[model samples]
Target: MPVTRANAMSKENKKVAVIGAGIIGMAVASCLQRDGHDIFVVDPNEPGLGASFGNAGVFGTSSVAPMSMPGAIRQVPKWLSDPYGPLAVRWSYLPFIAGWLARYIAAGRPDRVERQARALRDMLGRAVDNLAPLVEAAEATAVFHRNGSLFIYRSAEGFAKDRQTWDLRARNGVQWEELDAAALRQFEPSLSSNCTYGILVRTNGHTSNPHALVTCLAQNLIKRGATIHRTAAIGFVLDGDRLRAIRTTQGEIPVDAAVVAAGAFSRPLSRQLGDRLPLETERGYHIMISDPEVRPKVPIADQEAKFVATPMDTGLRLAGTVELAGLNAPPNWERSRILLHQARGLFPALRDNYPEDRLSLWMGHRPSLPDSLPVIDRSKRSPDVFYAFGHGHVGMASSGMTGMVLADLIAGRRPTIDITPFRANRFA
Candidate 1:
C-alpha cells in the first residue's frame, strides 16, 4: 500500500509527546504538527546524532529483503568464525542473545521470508516520495540526492549465487538493470576492474548528510512552535487506559498522547506498558574518508563484502556490518577499520594511505527485532500510548511512512497501509 495524506476523522488537536529525537522521532513530530497537534519532542542528546547520524544514507526503496533470508542460517557459522566478516557476535553476550538468535533463524523459513518481504515492500516502496515534502519543508533539499545506487559483484559466480535474492526483489516490484562487466565499467568507471557484474536499482537514492537532514527537520519543527525537551523520558504516568504525562529526568510533562520512538532504548519503556517485546541492538560501524581520490557517482554496495560506499557531503562513507553485541560494550574500532580495507577493493583509485585526521570512525546501535519488522501498534495498557521502534537497518529509509502511519493511528484514521504485521504482541 502506497502512503498518502488521508484526512483525520476528527480535527481536535492533542498535545503529543514524542520520545527520541532521532530521524524516526523527528519525522513523527513533523507529521503530527501537520495534523495540527501540539508536538513535544523529548531526548537528552542533540537530535539525529544517534544511529541516525551514521547510516549508509541510502533511501533503499528496493530493500525489501529481510536480514535473515533463506539459506542465511547455513552461513552464520562461517560469519561468526571470521573476525573481519560482515557479521560477528561477542562470545560473552551469546547467553543474552541466544533466544533472539533462535527467533532470527526461525524467521528465515522460506514461507516467513515471503510474507516479510511483502510487508516490507508495502512499508518501504514509496519512502522517497513520502519523505519529499518533509525534506522540502525543512528547507534541507540540498542534502537529498536521487542519483540511484549500484550493487556490484566481484565475479559471475558470485552474481549467480544471489539469483534468488534478486528474484525476490523483482517479484516485489523492485526494478533493476543488470550490468555485465563492460556495462558496469561504462556506468561507473571508478569501480575496480574485478567488479564483474552489477545491479543498478534506479529507484534508490541517498542523503548527502543524514545528520544535517534530520537536524534541519527538527529545527523546522521548533520554528513551527513545537517544543524540544532536552531530557530523557524515564516512564509514563497513566490513568486507566489513557496517558496523563511522561516522566522524565527533568520532570513530568503532561500530554494527551505519547509515542515511544526511542530507537534502541524502547524495549524497557514498552515493558513498563506490559508488552515485553524481543528487541536487541545490531551494533553497526562505519568509516568516513574526508578526501578520497575517487568518488562514485552514486552509492555502490559490494555484494560480497556487504558494505556500501556512498558519496556524502562530508566525505565518502563506507558503512555496514552487524555485531550482535549488546549495548554497553566497548567500541570495537577494528570493525570500522575493516570497512576501509573493503573500500580499497571496490575503488582502486582511492589512495592507499590517508592521514589519520582524514578518517572518521563511528559505531551506533540499530534497534532490531528478530523478524525484522518494527512494532507500530498501541501499547497493551493504553491506547493513548503508541509504540514505534525496532526499524533495524531500514529506519532511515522507512521513517517517513512509519511517522505518517503513526499520525493516522493517533488521529483516529486508518493508515494507508495494513499494519497487521507490526503488532506489538506478535511474538507472544
Candidate 2:
C-alpha cells in the first residue's frame, strides 16, 4: 500500500471541500486554511449544534480504554434489561446492528483490546496539547480550561474490577492519582458520600462551553476568509479516479479534493467513494440544568452510574449513554431523563426540578466504528477523497489531532504519527 501524497492528486493551490460544520470539519478547514488552501464547508445544520453542542466536553488525554473490553459481553444482558442502563439497543434495530455488535464484541479479545489501546494512546494522548494552538488562534482560551477530571468509584470492589484498565492506562503513559474518601471530599466536596475512591487525571481538561468552542473556531476561520455553504452534500462528481466536484443540494461546486467529516451522516457519503465502512451511530444523550444547586468543581464521572457531570459556563451538564438506533429514528428523551436521575446520586443537593426553559434535553448521533478507531486515510478509490469520521466517544477529545494529521496528509506530507491503525479500508 503506497501512500498517496496530496501533490499526486492535485497541485499545491488546491480548493478543498469539507463536508460538515461540526468540530471535526471545522478543525480540518481551519488547518487547511492555515496551510494556505481554499476551504469551503458544507452542512445543512447549524455549525456545532450536533454532538459537538452536547458532549460532556472532557479533553480526555488518558482515555485509552476501549468501551468494549474483556467481560463486556457478559454485561450486555444487564444493559439490555435495565432501561436506564448506560447502554441500550432498540430491539427493533438489533438486526440492523447485529453485524456491528458482533465485531464490537470480537474487538474485546484481550490481544485486540491491547492493540486498540496502544493505537488510542498514540492518537489521543496529546489531545489537549494538540488543540492548544488552535484554541489560542481562535481566541477561545476562555472556553478551554485544564481543571482536570475525576473518576469516582463507590466501593473498593468496583475500583478493583477495573485494575486491568488502569494498568493499560499506565502503560500508555497516563498520569493519575488515587484518592481515598477524605481526599476525594477534599478534591470535590459536592460529591456524594457513596463515592469512596477516586482517580484524578491531572492531564485531563474540558471546555467551558463545547458549542462555543466549535463556533469560535468556525468564526475565526470565516474571518480568515474561508467560504461556508449552508447546504447538504448529496454526492460527488468524479472524473475517472479523481473527484471533480461535490454535488450539494444548492448545486455542483467544483473542488480539488473533498473530505467526509459529516459525523453520523458520513457513512452514505463514504460509500459513494466505494469504502464500505462498518459505521454505526452511537446515539448519545445529555441533560443540562441551567440553575443547578450544586456544581462539581470539575468534570466528575461515576464509575457505577456511567455518566459524567461537568460544570459548563451556563450550567451543569450531565451527559452519557449509548443507544443504537438508526439515523432517522426519533430521539428517546427518556435517556436524557435517566442521566438527570443518576446525576442526582452523584450530587445529592441537586434540585429535583428546574424551570422548563432552564433545562435542555438533547440526543445526537456519534459516528462510531466497531473497534473504536476513526478512519483518517485517503480513499482507496480516489486519493482526492479523504475520511476523518468515526471518532466515536472521543471525537471532541481527538478532533485537533485528527485535523492536524488530515492537513499533513492534504499537504502531501506524512503525518508525524503513524496512522496505519486508522486506515479507511481496515475492514477489507
Candidate 3:
C-alpha cells in the first residue's frame, strides 16, 4: 500500500464523510477533524442513539477474552431452549445462523483461540491509553472512569474451570486477583451470598454514560466545524479505487474520504461498496436502575447469564444476553426483563432497578466477526474506503483507540501495531 500525495493534501484540506454517528463513527470523526480534515457525519437516528447508546458503559481495556472459548460451543443447545438461560439461540434459525456458529466453534480451537487472543490484546492494550485522553480531549471526562470489574461465579466448579484461562490472561498483561467466598463477601458486602468465587481485574474501567460520551464526541466534532447530517446512507460513488461521493437519503455528499463504522449495519453498506465481511449482530440488552439508591461500585459480569452490572450516571445498569437476530427485528424485551430479574439475584435489595421495560430497558446489536476480532484495515476494493467496524462486544472497550488508529491510517503514518492481523480480507 502506497500513500498518495493527493490523499495527503486532501486529508489536510479537503472534506471527509463518515457514515454513522455511533461512538465508533463519532470518535473517528473527532480524530480526523483534529488532525485537520473537514468531516460530515450521517445517520438515521440521533447521533449515538443507535447501538452506541445504552451500552453497559464499561471501559474494558483489560478484557482481552474472545467470545468463543474452549467450552462455549457445547452450551449452544441448552441455551437455545431456555428463555432465562445465559444465552438463547433461536433454534428455528439455526440453518442460517449455523455458519456463524461453525465459524465461532472453529475459533475455539486452541491455535485459533490463541491467535485471536493476541489480536484482542493488541487492540485492548492500546484502548485505555488512547481512550482516556480522547474522552478528556472531547471534554467529557465524566464518560471515562476506571472503577474496574468483577467476574463472579456462584459455584466452585465454575471457578475451577476458568482458572487455566488466567494464565492466558496473565500472558496478555491483564492483572486479576482471585477471591474465595469470604473474600468475595469482604470485597462487596452487598453481593448475594451465592457469589462464592470471583476475580477482580483492576485494569478495567467503565463509562458514566455511553450515550453521553457519543454525543459529546459528536458535539466536539461539530465544534470543530464538521457538518453532521441525519440521513440514510444508500451507497457510494466510486471512481476506480477512490470513492467520489456518498449516496445518502438526502443527496450525494461528495466525499474524498469515506469510512464504514456503522455498527452492525456496516455489512450492507460495505457490501454495496464491493466488500464482503462476515459480520453478525449480537444484540445485547441493558436495564438501567433509575432509582438513585441502586448502584454497583464497579461493573460485574455474572458467571452464568452473561449479564453485567455497571454503575452508570443514571443508576445501576444490568446488561447482557446475545441474540443473533439481524437488523429490524424487534428486540425481545423478555430478555431485558430477564436482566432485571437476574440483577436482583446479584443484589438482594432491588426495589428500584426501574419498574418496567419502558424506563430501564434498552437494546442494541453489537457488530461481531465470528472469530471475535474487529475489521480495522483499508478496503482492497476501494482505496478511498476504510473499515472500522466489527469491534464486537468490545466496541465500548476499543472505540477511542480505533479513532487514533484510523487517524494514523488516514494520515499515511504507520500504525503502532501490525495492522495486517486485522486486514479486511483476512476471511479470504
Candidate 4:
C-alpha cells in the first residue's frame, strides 16, 4: 500500500506483483490492495486449486515445531525402505534429496531445533489474529471454522511422546487441554476404542473449503481493483539488485516490487535471481471420501501414523506423510491406501464411509525449508524482491501472518514482528 512516507512529497507509487496464486500469494495481494497498493496476482492456475486447494486446512498455532525434529534425521533410512512409513526419499531422487537431507540433518541439532521452534512460533503465533480480519472482510466467514483440532493417541506411551511436543506448544503460549479417552469420546463419538489420551488445541481452527476461502479472497481482490492474471510465474527480469518485473509465459509483468511465493517452484526462480534458497518440496498425498454424512465436527490428528482427518465441505480428507520426491511424480496409491487404513483404524465407522469409486486421490509438493520456518524476508541481494514461500505443511496455518508481514514490508513500514529469523540468507 502507498502509505504517506517520511519523504512526504515523494509519493512512492507501488505496483506490487505477486508470483504464485497460492493462499500466500493471494493473501499478500489482498493485504497490499486493502492497504491501498496497486496489486496483481500471477499463477499457472486461476487461484488456489494447487497446494492451497487440497491442504488439510488446519490453522495450527501449535505447530511451532519444525518438520525435522531431533530424531527425524536418523529415521530417513527406515522411511525410505518402508512403503507406509511417515517419511521417505525415493532412490531415484536420492542424489538431489541427499543434499536436502544434509541440510535437514543439520537442522535437527538441538540449537537449530530451538531456533526453528522460536522462529515458527514467531511466524505462526500471530497468524490468525492478523488474517482473521481479512477473511471477515471477504464475507466468507463460513469457510473458516473454529471447531479446534484434537490429537488422539493410540497408546499411553504414544501419549507420553505427544507430551514432548505439547510441552513445546505450551511454552509458546498455545492454549491446549489434555483429554482422556472418556473426554475424547464425547466430541469424537466415532473414534474407535483403541484411541485413548488426547490433546485438544483450542487455539486451532480449519477451513472447511480452502479453495472457497482462496476464491473468496481472490474475488474480493478483483473487486478492490487487484488484477488476477492466469499465467505461470516462470522467472523474473532482474535489475541490478532487484527484480524489476515478473516473467511469465504470457509476457513480462512489469512491476516495482515482486513477491515470490511460488512454493516448491520458487527455488529455481530465486536461484536465477542469485538467491539460491534452500527450498525443497515435501511431496504429500491424500485420500478423500466425498461428503460423508455422519462426521465429527472437529478435526482429528492421529498420533499413530502422523496423519490428519479433516472433515471438509465436499468430503472428509485424510492427509499426511512427507515424501521427498521430485515434483510431477505419479500419485503413490500405497500412501493413499495407508491413509484410508489409518482413517479406518481411528474411526471404525469409516470402514463403510463411502463407495470405493467415490474416493479421490491428490498429490502436492509443499515447499519446505531445512528449518521448517517459512522464508518471509526480503532477498538480501534484491531490494524489490521479497519471499513468502517454504511454509511446508503449515502454509495455511501461517499464510495470514505472512501476508501481514509482506504488506508491512511493501508499505516500507517497520513490520510488527522481527524478520531476521525468516531471512532467506539464514541458510546461506
Model 3: how far residue 274 lies from native, Å: 2.2
TM-score of 2: 0.96
User: Which window of 10 residues has the lowest lDDT sum in candidate 2?
Assistant: 1-10
Model 3 off-target regions past 4 Å? Answer: 1-11, 351-354, 357-359
**Clashing pairs in model 3?**
57-207, 59-205, 59-206
Location of the lowest summed lDDT over 10 successive residues in candidate 1: 1-10
| Candidate 2 residue-wise lDDT, 302-399, digit = tens | 88889999999999999999999978899999999999889888888887777789899999899899999999999877889999999999998889
Ranking by lDDT: 1, 2, 4, 3
> Candidate 1's residue-wise lDDT over 294-350, tens digit each?
778899999899999999998999999999889999989999999988888999887
Considering only N, C-alpha and C atoms within 3 Å, which residue pairs clash in candidate 1?
none
Assess candidate 4 and give its TM-score to the true structure: 0.94
Candidate order by decreasing TM-score = 1, 2, 4, 3
When summed lDDT is taken over every stretch of 10 residues in candidate 4, the lowest stretch is 1-10
**Candidate 4 lDDT (Cα, 0 to 1):** 0.81
lDDT string, candidate 4, 116-145, tens digits: 788788878866666688899888799888
lDDT of each: 0.91, 0.89, 0.80, 0.81
Off by over 4 Å in 4: 1-10, 352-354
Q: Which segments of model 1 are wrong by more than 4 Å?
A: 1-11
Q: Where does candidate 2 stray beyond 4 Å? A: 1-10
